[model samples]
Target: MTRCRLCGSTALTSVVDLGATPPCESFLAEDQLDLPEPAYPLHLRVCADCWLAQLPPLIAPEETFREYAYFSSYSTSWVEHARTFVEGAVERLGLGADAFVVEVASNDGYLLRHVVDRGIRCLGVEPSVNVGAVAREAGVPTLTAFLSPETGAAVRGEHGPADLVVANNVYAHIPDVTGFTRGLRALVADDGWVSVEVQHLLTLIEENQYDTIYHEHFQYYTVASAARALASGGLTLVDVELLPTHGGSLRLWARPEGAAGEPTARVAEVLDREKAAGLQELSGYTEFSARVAKVRRDLLRFLVEAAERGETVVGYGAPGKGNTLLNHCGIRPDLLAYTVDRNPYKHGRYTPGTRIPILPPERIAADRPDYVLVLPWNLRTELVEQLSFVHEWGGRLVFPIPELSIVEVTS
Candidate 1:
């Protein structure tokens, strides 16, 4: 058995078993659909010593992010979230034209674009060449490389330390978070701050977010686990904020050691909340597998009933999480006729494992699917409003996780 990634403990416990699944973001083009694809086990386990839920590193980073399909600017609410965060950070950090900013995994310069517009010197370190090209085109200086201690040192030597290092939804994608956080410390100025956003593990267990589990996301973190990783990287937590994005995420602020960051009360408050909710205990994760199993059964039952009634069912998004859910639940194109997306890149392609046909959102109105499973349930409000025309035929919205729920929509 493999030891825990954060702490080398042989005492690893299973949390949720997602079975074998393909790379969630690896959408197949029409020409590539006939090719054989690889799959990996998607089970999650928690360390008895550190309580960090994790998956083994079967897929290398090079294959996962070389030319990624995910583009941050595609989501409206997400773009708004990034803009609001930049505004807040600029105000709180007192950033100006002289301040230098660095963003790790900065996809398409969605947030750094705001910083550049403010005249603050900004740079982005992106691993995906395809995504980095888009950022470079947007006038955001981007380096097509992964963040590491060596890479961090090189950037610091040439460009000097940064006042702010932004990491949003990138930590989970990384296998060596200890090394990644160390790179964040190596690149930031002595008095500068490192802000990281990760999907909260508490939300995963509570909201039945099994869909979020994939090979790319190697680790799941609670505040306790995250603080441990950051501390290992020579940083100290100063503040933590809960976000509604990505089901629920935690935005943690940290500073270099001996810099006197004086953590906010929210730090202890959230820790206490996690302890109160049993997140700090191994037993808390034991019941989660059963909770996730219930969801799989329920979703399968819903799809089967819909098909038996001679109703059409389709999906709304092609997010990585959606692929995990569909593959885990054994959903096929037979039950779900096809899925639609607003991103033209995903059009004319098929989901990784489920192989559900991908089409434009216009297909939803033309076919008028009786049930539209909102694949990205976290963005249900935005998708529902955008797809309000579905109400013309009394089309219903389905949320499979957090207990299968059917919602009625009005135009």
Candidate 2:
């Protein structure tokens, strides 16, 4: 029996099936055109015991993130987001020369750059070789290995326990959830705080964000489920904040039980809201699958209509979520033409399942396609501003999630 990753519950129900799909960032080369892509079961399940939403087991972390393709510094908005997060966290924690900060899965030192700038000692534990090299170039000392109980203990032995341990958007990606949390407990000092940012399950269902379900994201979290998971490893949630990044996310602050800091009203309020919404009930899982089906049908119909009208459609932002959405919808190059990405690594490669070629953003301006499908719909505002010149050709930007809407630009 496949037990729940969090609560060890054997009672689980399937929620949504995204079918077999390649890892979102598994871009292909021209020589690899004929190679069969490795597709895994993209099924989500809810733990009846703890109510944690999660994907079925598939690719291991070593296979998925050992040579990560994503670079956090590619997006201008994301860079600003990291900067703001660092500034706020440092101020909130009163971190200075005496404090040491450790960040897990710190891709390219995006957030740690600010910590180092403040003259505070910081260490980054990143598994991806290429990304860790970038972090090293940025002057952030990064260890190239997965963060687990053993690695965490080694880190603590060398650098001592951290005052602040930041793990932004890494909680959902870990498959061995129990071992990972235990690693956090081993690394965090008695009074230190471990802050984790994860895409909120409540927001994922409410916003119809099924595209976030790829092989790398092993677990989806609600504040209640997160608290339960942490408590199992001897930690307690002290505070929680709802963030707007990646559609919607939650920043959870945790520490050892009875160490310091009391659970904030926000934590209790969020947990209460999740319980009232039936997150812990089986009915919630059944309803979520139906909602996802509606989204698939709606998106397909919109793309078909556009194709019939001879509207030149192209995709913006070759993000992982975009890959999942396109692959699930069975969209290919005939409909999307090509996708634009700011990351150099993704450029000149083809998206996994669809095989849509990825090019630089300049292609959009040059081609001036009639319809630009904004794949990374979460960055609509920033993308619209950057590609506003498409208005010169009377082109419109199409957003295809939650609903399909075309926004016309007025110059």
Candidate 3:
């Protein structure tokens, strides 16, 4: 029986099957073409008791993120998001110079830089060696290891419990849900709070964002599921806030049970909203597979049509979501000439599974492809503004998911 990760209940049902897929960030090298590609079952299941949407068991964290290619400092929007988060957190938590802040999965110290600038002692826990090196260079005291119960104990012994623990967009990537949350419980000071940010599962299903179904994202969270997960580790969900970043996300505030202020009405409001939206029921995910299948078909048809017309069709963004979409839709060099990314680390590599080369944004301007498919559709507005020059050649931007549509510039 595949028990719920949060409640350990044996009552679970298969909700959506995305088939086998490689790790989205496993970009390949030209010389490594002969290496056998590994693809695992990308099936999602819903826990009846906890309502936590999650993929079936597969790859371990070491295999998934040891040499992670993604660096948070590469994206301007993400950097801005981090800056805003730091400002809000410092003010809301009433943090001062003497208080210590710690962030898990702090890629390139994107968020902690602001914390450090405030004269607050800070630490970052990052598993990826390459990315950790970058964070170290930024003057952030980074521990190059995964966040586990043992690590938490060790960190507490050395630095004492943290006043604030920030885990942005890392909650979903952890496979050992129980151990991870326990680690949070051990590391947070009695009066401290831990804020976890994750892409909302409700938003993912409603927006047809099946492309976010990569191997690394093991669990999809709603307020109820997250509450249950934290409570299991002796933490309480005190508050929840919705954010527009990453399409849609939830910032959950948690603290040790009986440690702080009472749970706010906002927490109940989000839970009630999720339940009303059928997030707690298994039938809520029944239509998700069909919706995603339709997306796959539509995207494939559009790319095939563009190819037959001899029009150059390229992709934008090398995000994990983009890799999932490309691989699922069978996109390759024959269909997409190349993909453009602003990140220097990803520029010269080939996308996993599809093997489409990743080039700099300059390639988009130089090629002026007839169609530039925006893979990270969530960033459409920002990307379109930056690449508006494509309109100079009568080229248009295409969004594949939530339906395929092309946008034309008037000016």
Candidate 4:
């Protein structure tokens, strides 16, 4: 933390301090509830040299991912998103049966299954043993190991150089950004394409999506800074696409420096947008802490008022981001009652710090709470339809990010 993780610079400035919270995905079992829990400083800082927004590497990847609780297949919309990405990648990269594809941190084979269907050889390098087992059971060729320069080289040697390397929603998870990017280089063919999807810092600040900040995500990247990180591993940013997933994300296309020609116009366009948003300078970040404070205040006020009015407020989706929001707001079972999730693994567990009980999604219908707080608000569209049954009991849904808003479901 003394030096920037990306640039090794000591000139790091505070972005926002979210106090301290437990690791976002560390759900506690019933027996462990009475034991002491651990928390870390959830403060975010920006590197003055590289403009990369990041948190200190308080927790190691091995501590969190070895036996992960998150299963990507639980989210129907995310599964569909993976399917679409595979189809597009096949077409965009002219991949065929001869093509070799690799996905880093491929959870539960949610994405590479599509590659398998198309007869393209694919491999998933995942760090989590439990989730990697599920991927192997589902027929994905998975290696239960974390991605690193050595791991990547071993994969390339054993499986042959990959034609396409896909890393989705994992670019920000590693504390060693430069090393991880080098791993990507080692796995991919000299002329092969590398695609990475990460939450865009610009949208994170503009949309008031501070809840996404957690220990798991070591760094947040704008295209400008991302390009610099990619260069450290000899990868050149070729094209950029703005994606709607993970609130707002960037799909960066990169290649080995020798094969990467000039970057696409879209890359310049996105960089211009980032600069215009004041991200390259300190101006854009100056007011983010105040806005984040306002969000916390507004959400706490609503929950407090709901309690006073004798209205029941429960949460939906025990996602990692939801844990950050709940812990930061200091919400416990008293204010939230209990939350429901589609993931069976979390049904009987409690959220890490807040200790909110996680029940099956059907519990909402069985108990019919007055308000269902939508924690994974990024999946709002898909969840609304899934929870439309709330309309039967005149129940409404609540969203806390991008400002708090409530919507009454109609049958």
lDDT of 1 by residue, 1-411 (tens): 489888898989888888999999999988887899899998899898888889999998889899898999999999999999999999999998899999999999999999988999989999999999999999999999999999999999989999999999998988888899999999999999999999999999988898999988999889999999999899999999999999999999999988846789999999998888888777688888888889999999999999999999999989999999999988999899999988888999999988899999888888888999999999977987887787899999998878899988888
Order of candidates by TM-score, top first? Answer: 4, 1, 2, 3
Best by TM-score: 4
lDDT of 3 by residue, 292-410 (tens): 88998988888889899999999889999998888888888999999988888887889988889999989888888999999889887777787788889999999986778899853
- Alpha carbon lDDT of each predicted model: 0.91, 0.88, 0.87, 0.94
TM-score of 1: 0.98
* Native RMSD of candidate 3 (Å): 1.3
Backbone N/Cα/C clashes per model: 0, 0, 0, 0
Model 4 pairs whose backbones collide: none
**Which regions of candidate 1 deviate over 4 angstroms?**
none
Q: Which residue pairs clash within candidate 3?
A: none
TM-score of each prediction: 0.98, 0.97, 0.97, 0.99
Residue 13 in candidate 2 has what lDDT?
84
Better of 1 and 3 by TM-score: 1
After best superposition, candidate 2 residue 315: deviation in angstroms? Answer: 0.3
Q: Which ten residues in a row have the lowest lDDT in candidate 2?
A: 283-292
lDDT for model 4 comes to 0.94
Off by over 4 Å in 4: none
